[model samples]
Target: MEHRVSLITVGARDVETLAAFYEALGWTRVDSPDGVIAFDLLGQSLGIYPLAALADEIGVPESDLGHGAMALSHNVREKADVAPLLDRAQAAGGRLLKPAQDVFWGGHHGYFADPEGHIWEVAWNPFSALGPRGEFQWNGVG
Candidate 1:
């Protein structure tokens, strides 16, 4: 089996709605077939699909979608960029969870929830440098 992830599918209650939120964040969504939308990231793709359809395809109930236990993160290039990113998220229908602040690890971070309650963390870690394509080579979120 491969050791890296090539895609990430987010089960959204409303596929189009959630997709728009990401689009508002300046993410260019790639064309996908019916019932799914995709956004190409630095080294992977972010796919958005209807929650019910995804659950049915997996042969599980919608409750199987892990809620609070997991979070998606986007690491920025500069510490000053954190607040604006969080603001952009909030302006795009995401609920502000934790306002951007200095973390104990000397980094700055914030949290927000999409319209469907999917948690996303926006952080700036000086320790983990982002390449030109926004790829983070670090092992941890910090």
Candidate 2:
């Protein structure tokens, strides 16, 4: 088993709606016909599949699995962008969990939960480096 995650597939109750939500956040679907929509996140892939179908494909029962204990994070270049992105998330059917604020770690960040209860953190760290794709390069600072 490799100690790396190549993909993160989210089981969405409404695939098309969820896809549109992420697309509004600047993610493009990778061309595919299986109805599995995907977005390239840095060098990794984030996929969205129908909930029941995903459970069937994985041979798992569709129950309250509590797999959303973790959150996905998006880091930005300027601290000023955090509030606007949080607002966008809210406008796209996501629930705001936290308002953008300065963290004890010295960064500005906030949280939102998608329609399917997937938590996401949008942050802006002054000491971090951003790639062309808006992905972060850790700067080893608090």
Candidate 3:
């Protein structure tokens, strides 16, 4: 397998509502099949699907499909862009989990929870400068 993610799918209680929340965040939807909503990113796509259906497909009970201990991160090119994006997420019906501030690692960052309760980190890492098209690498864009 290659070291790349083709898609990141999140199960939402209400797929349409969750999809709209992403749309509110300035993500335009691509043409996808009926059961899913997808937004294409630089090299991958974010997918939203029905929570119950996802649980069934995974052979798990819906109750066991709660939010996991993981977060999705969005890296920005400028530290100044951190707070505003958090605010934007809040205004779009998400919850602000943390206010942007200087990190011990010499970066600025914050967190927010989308409508489906998926946590997301918005960070600007000076050590990992993004590529020309906003692709992220752990130690700066090669």
How does model 1 fare in lDDT?
A: 0.89
The best candidate by lDDT is 3
Worst lDDT run of 10 residues, candidate 3, spans 29-38
lDDT of 2 at 66: 49
Each model's TM-score, in the order given?
0.92, 0.86, 0.96
Task: Give the winner by TM-score.
Answer: 3
- Candidate 1 residues lying further than 4 Å off, grouped into runs, are 66-68, 139-142
Which wins on lDDT, candidate 2 or candidate 3?
3
Give candidate 3's error at residue 74 in angstroms.
0.2
Pairs that collide, model 3: none
RMSD of 1: 2.3
lDDT of each: 0.89, 0.86, 0.93
Off by over 4 Å in 3: none
lDDT of 3 by residue, 35-112 (tens): 988999989999998999899999999999989999999999999999999999999999999999999989999999
